[model samples]
Target chain A: MVEPVLDVKGLEKSFGALKATNGASLDLRPGEIHALIGPNGAGKSTLINQISGALAPDAGSIRFLGTDITMLDTARRARMGLARTFQISSLAQEFSALRNVMLAVQARQGTSLRFFRPVASDVSLTEPAMRMLSRVGLADRANVPAAALSHGERRQLEIAVALAMEPKAFLLDEPMAGMGPEGSKALTGFLDGLRREAPILLVEHDMDAVFALADRVSVLVYGRIIATGSVSEIRNDPEVRRAYLGEPA
Target chain B: MGARETTVNVLLVLLLPAVALTALFIGEAFYITLATRIAILALAAVGLNIALGLGGLVSFGHAAFFGLGGYVAGVLATHAFNMEPVAFGLPGTTAMPAIWLVAILLCGLVALPIGLVSLRTSGVYFIMITLAFAQMIYYFAISWPAYGGEDGLSLSMRNGFPGLNTAKPFPYFVVVFVLLLAGLLLFHRLRASRFGAALEAARQNPARLAAIGISPFAIRLVAFVLSAMITGLAGALFADLNRFVSPSMLSWHMSGELIVLIILGGKNRLFGPLAGAALYVLFEYALGGLTERWQLFLGLVLLAVVFFARGGLIGLLAGRPRHG
Candidate 1:
């Protein structure tokens, strides 16, 4: 069996009386896209937050690259090559698109403490940043501020920033949330090939993208993984069809 | 920077020294003193801008550092004049360079703990905590009779600078002008550096910065300490200018004034503090000559700027910034 790139076991979270994540366990293997789909308020975001170290799980253990990262903070996890994108587009709005991506590149280089040289003139940061921007098809818009980018363009920029992290594993939460149909189709195609770079744990509402790109699918309902299997098995599973697909059993 | 801003910055850089030198040549010593005052205040505000403008950490107690710097100079100069050892049997020296070095190091030391506690909370809480820290220092300075307490300490003469005679208003103004230029240069370099990129990003979205593996707290703390050091240096110069150091230097009003200077010139803009200081001093001079209640008019102008000219003087002159 392939050693998983990321492993989460028995994750649990509670907000007051509501259980946000309840005994959830999942993992992502190398060179495969793992799509996690659930209805709204099924605690998908909470689970992602816990795995990414944004929120601490009440009870759980997460191992990434075979190291126990359950107690790490978000920045520490990121430095260890765990990169994630926000469901909401969060970026340095005033920074140029190239600069935004360069932030990730700079972080990856661990030279954020370098205080004297001009960042704009640093080819070590700019070259890789520009390459990521071109890959995301935002090369021409590199000089434009993130705030000025189109909605679809901003989503692409977010991915570009994440790509600049050189992540070992990607936890992309709702990457297609605000993208248009055409944008979604294009990004689905892009994400399909991105698995070659790093294994992805994708949380998406776009079922077509999920089904089209996922090597495996996990149906999460009310903070629990009801089923994990290949796309065909998840599509035909009676429990998944009834609870998530909203089909009569 | 755009051509327009470059031109404006050049003009600002030239205007102060030009006016002061002209005053020197023409024997208008009072104008030279006024120019010195503007330069010192602007330098202090420039220090505050690093934290408040770039890092978006609104520190309301920067006067703590400013006054700390002042007291360093005052205490050292007093001990030197009395020929007494200033603690640890270390002889006090009136050298400007040595005083500034001690002031900068002490302020950085003080800022570390203050920033460690204050950066934990942001927005109004951050402001209140910083203000509280400054007020604590202010009261301590008042109650501590060893350094004159509320009566304040005074230097018998302006502190010494190597080679140059700082006793003359013009030479002293020259020293201050050079330091102001250095401060602006530091601000420009820091604003363009990789650390600056992270600081600005931390300001815009700390979560995004953290997601990319940068700790916002670390960035903010560094910025805060650096800011305090710059402000502290300015305080040393300010005390030498007046030959006096008092708790009033650490007062909350002084803190508020530093922030006001930044806003009046233009927050975050290079030369914002200088422009604001020039305007503030001009108001003080022009208004003080006319009426005792001049602050009323200053208040109105500040209101107008806050209401109508959100960008302050530089924004009005150079136009809206190309990038935020």
Candidate 2:
């Protein structure tokens, strides 16, 4: 069997009496869209946070490319090619869209430590950053500050930033949130093609986009993986139906 | 970038040196001394602006570094005067370059730990912790009897600068003015660099900074240490200007005034500290000459500026906050 690019095993976390994640195990193979689906407050985001190193699991082992990364910092994990985006918009609001993406490009190129040269005029940094921006269809709005961008545009900018990371895998949490249907359709198409670049562990609620894009689906209920299968099988599973899909068992 | 901002900057860069030179030509040593104060204070505020304006780290412990710089100058000047061999068997020298090197190194050494500890907490907690650490240093200065202690130490003469008679106010002002200009140019370069972009981004959203594969803690820490070194250098100049080193340099009021200098001119503007320092010194000279109770008038003026002018004097003039 091919080794998964991102592997998590027996992960667990608790806040007082509540278990945010309970022995959750999953693996993301290269170039596959593995969608994680759950009802609201089912700890999908919590699990993503733990996987992304934003929140540490109380007990678990996460191996990326076969190296254990459970104790690594979020930035270190990102540097190692594990990229992520927040569910809520987390961006440098005051920065223009081009500059925001340029930061990611600078980080990736290891040029952020160079203090003398102007990043604005550096063709090396701006060229790739602009390419990433264009990928998200934000080519024209590159100079607008992130705070001033419409909600859909901010979401697009986040994708541009992530793309600039040159990631080994992507952990996108609710990338479709706050996006109108047209924007959703556009991004859904983009993410579909993006999965070919790197495997994606997609945590999302929009079932239409999820079902359309996922190679396989895992139904998470109360932090446990209740079922994992191809999209249609998981969609028709009785456990997912009663516990999550709000259908009679 | 606006026409008004460019004109204001031209005036700011020109007026002080012009006035200082004119005063020197008129043979008024007192006015030259005042200009030196502005240059030194502006230099100190420029250092604080790196952390405060760009990185958005409001370091209240900056006075600690400033005072440390002053003390470095004082202790070395004292040891050199007494012909005492100091630690590491290196005899103290009254050389400006030597004193500046020692001051910057010592400030960096102290700032590393202070920044490491304080940067772990942010907002008001960070502010209080930095202030508390500075106060600790202040108390230590008062109690350390080997130096002048509570009364402070006085230099026998100004530290020597090679190829210049620094005892003369005009030449001394030239030294300070040149250093301050160099610092401003460096600040401009740093603000436009890649490091600066990440630092500013960290201030806006640390999580996003991390997501982009840069550690916010590391960025802010570097900025803090650099800020300390700059302020420490200014402190060295300030001690030389007055030919005195005291605990007051380490006081919270000193820290507050440094921040006020940044704010009064405009927070984060490259010329904000210079503008604020010029205005502050002007207020001190003008209002101080008029009445004994000038601080009250200064307070009222400051209140009007803070309440009505959110971006500060530069913001009032420049049509926008340049650095924010």
State fnat for each of the candidate structures. Answer: 0.82, 0.80
Instruction: Please give the distance, in angstroms, between residue B296's alpha carbon in candidate 2 and its true position after superposition.
Output: 2.8
Off by over 4 Å in 1: none
lDDT of 2 by residue, B1-324 (tens): 567888988899898788888898898889989989998999999999999999999999899999999999999999999999778888988999999999999999999999999999999999999999999999999999999999999999999999999999988899999999989988888889999999999989999999878999999999999999999999999999999999999999999999989989888788899999999999999999999898788788789889998678888998774332
Scoring model 2 with DockQ, what do you get? 0.71
**Deviation of model 2 at B139, angstroms:** 1.2
Best by lDDT: 1
Q: Is the docking of candidate 1 incorrect, acceptable, medium or high quality?
A: medium
DockQ for model 1 equals: 0.78
RMSD to true structure for each model, in Å: 1.0, 1.3
Native contact fraction of candidate 2?
Answer: 0.80
**lDDT for each residue of candidate 1 in A1-249, tens digit (9 for 90 to 100):** 999999999999999999999999999999999999999999999999999888999998999999999999999999999999999899999999999999999999998887789988889989999999999999999999999999889999999999999999999999999889999999999999999999999999999999999999999999999999999999999999999999999
After the best TM-score superposition of candidate 2, give how far the Cα of residue B144 lies from its true spot, in angstroms: 1.0
The local lDDT score (0 to 100) that residue A207 gets in candidate 2 is: 92
lDDT of each: 0.95, 0.92
